[model samples]
Target chain A: MKTFFLSDGDLDEFVTNLIAKSPVFAPVAKKTRFVFNQLESVEDLRLDYDTTILPPKKLFVPTKQDLVTFEHGKYEECLAPGKKILFGVHPYDIKAISMMDWIHEESNFDIYYHSNRKATTIIGSNVQNHYKKAFFGSVCKELKVMGHDMFLTKIADGYLVEVLTKKGDDLLPDGNFTDVSKEQIKNAADVNTKADENCPSKLKNTSLEIKHKIRMYYDSDVWKKKSENCFSCGSCNIVCPTCYCFDIQDEWALEPTSGKRYRRWDACLTCEFSEVSVQGGSENFREERAERFRHRIMRKTSFLNDKLGGPACVGCGRCSGTCTADIADPVSIINEIMEK
Target chain B: MSCSSNHDKNIFLPKNAIIRKASQMTAFETHFTLKMEDESEFIYEPGQIVEAGLFGYGEIPLGLSSSPTQQGSFELVVREVGKVSKALCALKAGDTMTIRGPLGKGFPVSEFVGQDVLIVAGGIGLCPTRSMIRYIMDRRDEFKDFKLLFGARSPDELLFEDDLAYWRCSSDVNYLETVDKPNDRWKGNIGVITTLFEGIDHLDPATRVIICGPPIMYKFVIAQLAKYNISEHHIFVDLERRMKCGVGKCGHCQINDKYVCMDGPVFRYSDIKDLEEAI
Candidate 1:
C-alpha cells in the first residue's frame, strides 16, 4: 500500500485532470439533498457533504436493467459494467456493499452485480459532516470501514490519500507527490475519531445484542403496535442499500415475437412479495401489513445476521429518513422491543 | 473485500425448451409435457421445482411432476392464475419456453428406502408427489407398504386419474381417494383426505408420511398423523413461494432464515415446524 499527499490547491488540479480522463460519480448538491451524480465539472464535487439521499447501491444494481432480449430469431444480452469511478463514498456504504457481495456470490453467482462491482472503482471518504438520522457509531462500533480501494481523510495540510490496494496504487496521480509526515497521520486519525463522535442517533443496544433480542422476541406483539401506521409505501426499501429484492418482467414490442426481459427493484413490504400461489385463492405468506413490516426488520436484525456474521444494516439512516411513516425507524422500534 | 474480481456464470439465463404436449386437465389447469431443446435429461427429485415460462411472458416456479425415471422429458401441471401461468397454459405441442432449475431441496426419498411410506396429497398438490410415487413404484422391491391417500374439492378436480386407476389395481400401492363434493356418478369415499386415513392400517411411528396441499390442510393432516404416533421427523412437507431468480438472490422466496428456493421447497416437519411463516 502507498500513500499520497494533495494540498487544497493541488487537489483542485488533480480532480480537474481526473475528470477529463475518465467519468466520475461524486456527491453533488440535489437542491437541499445530495446525490451521487456524474460530475460535469470538478467544482460540482462535494466531498464535504453530510449525506446522499440514496446510497451508492444504485450504481451497482440500478433500479431497472434489461437483462435478455429476443428479436428476429436472435437472443442477445445487454450486459456490461460501464467503467466509472465512484469517488467520496462513505465507509458505512462500503460495508453494505460487502454484504451485497456475499449475498450475490453465496450460491448462484449474480453476474449482473459482480460485473458492475468489478468495473467500478470505489474511493472512500470519512464523514466530514454527520447526518441527524445516522447512528453508525452505536451499531457498528468496531467497524474499520474497510473495502475501499483508496481512502481519503481530511488533514491540516490538505487530504491524506491512502492507497489500500494495487488498483489504488495504479490510480494515483502520475507526478507531483509529497511524502506524508507523522503530523499529517495524526490529523487523519483525528478526522476519523471525530466522524464517530459526531453521530447524533443511536439504538438502545449493539447490533449483536439486538440480533439476539429480535430472535427471542420473534412473536412479540410489539411489532404489531410499531407497524400499525405503515402505509405499505416502500420508500424505506427504495432508499436503503441492503434492500436487494427484485421483480422480473417481460415486454414485447409492436411485433409480438420480439421482446425483452428485465428486472426492477421490488420491496418485501408490498403485499405480493411472497405470494407465489396463483391458484383459486392466492397464498401470500406475509400478506398483512404488520407481518411485512416485521419481515423487513427480521432480515436486517436476525435472518441475514445469522449468515453475514453481523447485522446487515450499516446504520445508513436512508431507510429511517426516507420512510414517510414515522414508525420505520429501526432504532426506535428495537428500543421499544428491548424496553418491553 | 475489494471489487477486483469478476464472475462469468449468469444464473438468471434460462435454457430453451420445447413443450412436447399440452392439454387441458381441468377448467383452470393445463398439463404440459416439456423437453429440453437438445432432448437432454431433466433429472429432478420429487419436491424440486423449475422456473418455467414462455419467453414473451415471464417465469414462475413450477414443481416437477414427472419422475426422474421418466428420462429425456418432464411434466408440469400449471393452473391459469396469473400472466405467466396463463401463457404457459395456452402453450401447445412444439411451443417453446424457458427453463432454469432442478432447484430447491427435494423430498428425502432414499431415506424412505426400506420404510413404510404414506403419501397424502390434496387438490393439485399431487403433481410433485407424483414424481416420487412413480420413482418408488419403478423400484418397488426397495420399499415396503406404499399407500396413497388423495382428496380434492370435487371428483372432477382430481389430477392424474390414469395413475390413480393403475395404483388402485397394482400390488405396488394401497391407494384411497376421497372428495369433498362428489358427483352423482362417484363411487369412492366422500370426505376430506384425513377421513380416508382411517382405512389405512399397519402404521406406526416409523411411517414416512409425506403431505402436500393447500396451506390450510397441513394442520388437520398433522393432527390426524399424531393419532398414529408418527413423529414429526418422519413427515415431510412440500411448500411454495414467489420466486424470481430461482437461485435465491431475489429474496421473494425467503421464509425467515431459509430461502425456500434454496434450503427447501421440501422440508421435514420437525425442521421447519417452528418457522411461523411456513405452514
Candidate 2:
C-alpha cells in the first residue's frame, strides 16, 4: 500500500481525468437526500454527503436484471453488464460489498454477483460529511477496511491517496500525487479514525455478548412489542446494503415463443418471502410480524455472524432513518435486549 | 449465451428437457417423464430434488420419483398445487420445461446394508420414497427384510397402484396398504398409517426407518417409533421449505442457520431435532 499527497487543485484534476477516462458513478445531490449516480462532471462529485438513500450494493447486485433467456426449448444464461468505475463509496459500503462477495462465493458460486463484482473497480473514501456523525457504534471501529481498489482521505490542504491494489496503481495518472510528509500522513490517519469514531448510539455489550443476547431473546416478547408498530413496508430491507434475497420470474417478449427469466431484489419481511402453496391453500413459514422482525435481527446479529466473523449490520443507520414506523432502529432494539 | 454465463459455474441455470410424458395420476397430481434434450444421463439418488419448471412460469423443487438407474430421463410426480406446479401438470408430451440440480443430500442406502429397511410414505410422500424403495429392491440380497407401509386419503388417491401390486406378490418385500376411508372395492386395512405399526411392533434396534408425509404425520409417526428401542439417529425425514435459489442465498429455506437446499432436504432426525422450524 502506497500513500501520497495531492493538493486540492491537483486532486480535482485527477478526478476529472478519471471521469473522462471511464463511466464514473459517484455520490451526488438527489432532492433533499444524496445518491450515487453517474457523474456528469468532476463538480458533480459530492464528497461531503452524510449518507446515500441506497447503498452502493445496488450497483453491484442490481435491483433487477435478466439472468436467463428462453427461446422455444433452449435455455441460456445472460452475461452481466460491462465494467465501470464505482466511485466515492464510503467505508461501511466497502465492507458491505466485501461481505456480498464472501456470501455469494462462500459455498455455491453466484455467477451474476461474481461477474458483476469483477466488472467494476471500487474507489473508497472516508466520510467527509463530518458535520453530522452517522456512525454504526463501537462496532464501527471493528469494521475492517477492505475490498477497495483505491481509498481517499480528505486532509486540510489536500487529499491523502492510498493506492491499495494493482488496479489503483494502474489508474493513477502521471503527475498530481506526490510523497506525503509525516505530519500530512498523521493528519490522514486522524481523518480515517474520525470515520470509525462517529457513532450515534453505542453498543453497550461486546460483540459476542450482543450475539448471545440476540440468541437468548429469540422467544422474548421484545420482538412482538417491536413489531407491533412496524409497517412491513420493506424500507429497512430495501435500504440495507447486505440484504441479498431475490425472486426469479419469467417475462414474455414481443415474440410469443421468446422470454427471459429475470431476478429482482426480494424483501424477507413480506409474506411472499417464504410462502409455499399447498394442495389448494398456502403456507407461510413466518406468518407473524414478530417472527419476521425476529428473523431479520437474528440474521444480522447471529445467523450470518458465524460465516462473516461479525455482525452483518454495518451500523450505517439508514434503516432507522428510513423507517416510517420508527421501530426498525437496531440501536434501540439491540440495547433493549441487552438491558433485559 | 456467452462463455462468462456458461454452465460451468452458473449453478442457477437449468437444463433443457422435453416432457416425454405428462399423464394424470390423480385429480390433483400429474406424473411427468422428462428426457434431457441432449439425451445425457440424469444421475441422482432418491430423496434428492430437481428445480422443475417451464419458462413462462417460475421453478419449484420437486423430488425425483424414479430411481437414478433410469438414465437419459427422469420422473416427477407433481401435485397441481401452485402456479408453477399447475403449469407443470398442464404440460404434455413434446412440450418443453427446464430442470436444475439433482441437488441436496440424498438417502444413504449403503448405511442400510444388512439392516431391516422400513419406508413409510403417506399420500404424495411416496414420490421421494419411490426411488429409495426401488433402489433397495434392485439389490435385495444386500439388505434384510423390506417393508413398505403406504396410506392414502382414499382408494382413488392411492398412487403407484401397479408398483404396489407387484410388491405385494414379491417375497423380497412385505407390502402393506391402508386408506383413511375405504370404498366398496377396497378390502385392505382402513386406518391411519400409525395403526399399521401395531402389526409390526416386534422390531429390532438395528432397523432403519424413514418417514415422509405432511407435518402432522411426523408427530404421530415419531411417537410410535419412539416406543421401540431403535436408535434415534437411525430415523430420517425429508422436510420442505420455500426456496428460490438452490444455492442457499435466497434466505427463504433457512431454518436457523441450516440451509435446507445445502444441508438437506433429507436430514437424519437426530441431527435436525434441535432445529425448531424443521419438523
Candidate 3:
C-alpha cells in the first residue's frame, strides 16, 4: 500500500536480508539463457534479465508431486513446503500465476496448489528488458500492477518499489527504503509504459478475436500443417507457465502394502495424454497428433478462456523459445490464421 | 510442515467401506454390496457413479447399480476389465475398500414422472439403468406405460437374471429382451436391441427414452428412436469417459468444453449431439 525508492546498494541489502529470512528464488543467468533458481547471493538476482527458461510456476505446481502416501490401510497427505519469497518475477509470469490460482481454486479446490500459493510471497518486477520471442505487449496489454506482495520497477538511478500487500509492508520495517516522491512515481510509471511498448514480438489479432477464430478453425488444415514439424517432445508444455495438465500414478514399495500416489506434469501433445485402455486393451480417444495439436490451441485460446474468464496463454513466449521444431509459437500460428 | 488441518480439506480422501456381499453375476462381471464403515446411508440418484478402489491400487469410476431407495448399503456391478476393476472383483465379503463420491450428473428422474418411460439397456449398460428401473418400480403408480427393452450379446451375458424374471412377470410393466446371438438352450427374440422396438404398435411422443449401452449401440438405438418420432430432447443417454478425478479438476473426462464428471455423465441427446467427441 506504499511506494518507496531504493538505491542499488540498498536493494542488494534488502535482497540479502530477504534471503536470510527464508529461501529466496530469482532469475540467474545460465550460460546463454536465464533460469529461476535459489538465490544464494544478492548478485544472482537478475532484475534486468529478459526471461527465464521455465516460469516460476514450477515452485507452486511442481513438475512432480506426491498427492498421498498409503501404508496398509492408512493414508497420509504430502505437505507443502514452508514459507518462502519468490523474488524478481516478471509481470507476465505474475499474471500467469494468478490464472493458475483461479484454475486450482474454482475447480475441486486443489489443496496441493493452494498450500504452496498461500505459503509463497511473490515479489514481481516490471519488464525492463524484453526477449526476442516475447509478445506480451499484444496479448497481455493491461498488466496488473498490484497482484504481488511487492513490485519493483527500474526508475532513473534507483528502483521504485510499490508495496502492495501487508506482507510487503513487513519487509520494509527494516528501514532499507526511502519515501518515494510524486515525480519519482510518475517517472517509474513512464518507464513501465515504455517497456511495455518495446516488446520485440507482437500478435496480429487480439486475444478475443483469436479466441473466436480458434473455435471455427477446429477442423482447419493449419494445425496439421504447422504441427508437421512437431517432435511431440512436449517441450512447449514443459516450458509453459500455464500448462497444468497432469497424470496421476501410484507407486508401490517392495512390501506391496506401502506406496505413494503422485501426479506428474503431462502434455496434451503426447500420444498417451488422452488414451484410455478399455476392455481387451484398446486406446479409444484422441489418437491422432493433429487432434492433440488442435486441443492445445483450443484449450489455451477458447476452452479455458470461456470458463476461466481469460485465455490461458500469458504470451510469455517460453513455449516458442524452447520448441526446437519452431512450431509452438502462438503469435506465428495466430498471425497465419489472420492472413487466411 | 504441518499438513493435518489441510488434509481434512483434501477432497480426494475416501471414506472406508466394507463389502457386505460379493457375487459373480457373469463370467466377466462381479456384483458387490458395499456399506459404509459407520453403516450410514449413501444417498445418491440413479445414474451417478462412485470412485471405488483399494488402497494400493488407484480408483476407477463405477456406476451405482442399486436403487437410491435402498438405504445403508449400495450395489456396484463391476466388469472385470481394467486393473482396478479386476482388483474390485477379487474383493470378498469383509474386505475393505475406499470410496469417494456419489459424483457426476445423474438421470433426471423427476422430469420423467407421469410420462411414458422406455428404458433400453444392452449388455453391461444395464448396470446403471438398474438403479433407475428399481426407482421407477418403487414409484410405479406415478408413471405410465413403462417399457423395458434389454439386449445382451448372448444368454450368458445377461446381467441381473433375478430382476429380469420379476420384470417379465409383472403385469404393470412391459419387458422385452433380445440377444445378438443365442445359445443352444436360449429361448428369446434374437437380434440387436433396436429390433425390439418393432414389436410395439403405438409410439407415444411424450415417451422419455433412456438408453445406455456400449458406445457402438448408441447410433443404431437413436436411429430407431427417431422412427417413433421422439424429439432429441426426449432421449437421454449415459456416456462413459476416463474419469481419473470425480471432480472437474481432472481433464481426462472432458469432451470439448464440457467436463463429463461435472457437466454430465448423463446428457440429453439434444444437449451434446453437437459435441463431436461426446458420442
Superposed model 3: Cα runs more than 4 Å off: A140-146, B1-8
In candidate 2, which residue ranges exceed 4 Å CA deviation? A130-135, A140-143, B1-7
Summarize candidate 1's per-residue lDDT along B137-239 as a digit string, tens digits.
Answer: 9889999898888999998897877888898899889888999999998998998888997886658689898899888899999999998899999999988
lDDT of 2 by residue, A42-126 (tens): 8888988878999988877788978898887677889856778888888888888888888887777788887888878898887
Ranking of models by TM-score: 1, 2, 3
Off by over 4 Å in 1: A141-144, A174-176, B1-6
**Worst 10-residue stretch by lDDT in candidate 1 chain A?**
A138-147
Descending-DockQ candidate ranking = 1, 2, 3
Model 3 docking grade? acceptable
What is the TM-score, restricted to chain A, for candidate 1? 0.95
Ranking by lDDT: 3, 1, 2
Native-to-model Cα distance after best TM-score fit, residue B32 in candidate 3, in Å: 1.1
Global local distance difference test of model 1 = 0.84
State how far residue A58 of model 3 sits from its true place (Å): 1.8
Q: Score the docking of each candidate (DockQ).
A: 0.59, 0.49, 0.37
* Model with the higher lDDT, candidate 1 or 2: 1
* Chain B TM-score for the candidates in order: 0.95, 0.94, 0.95
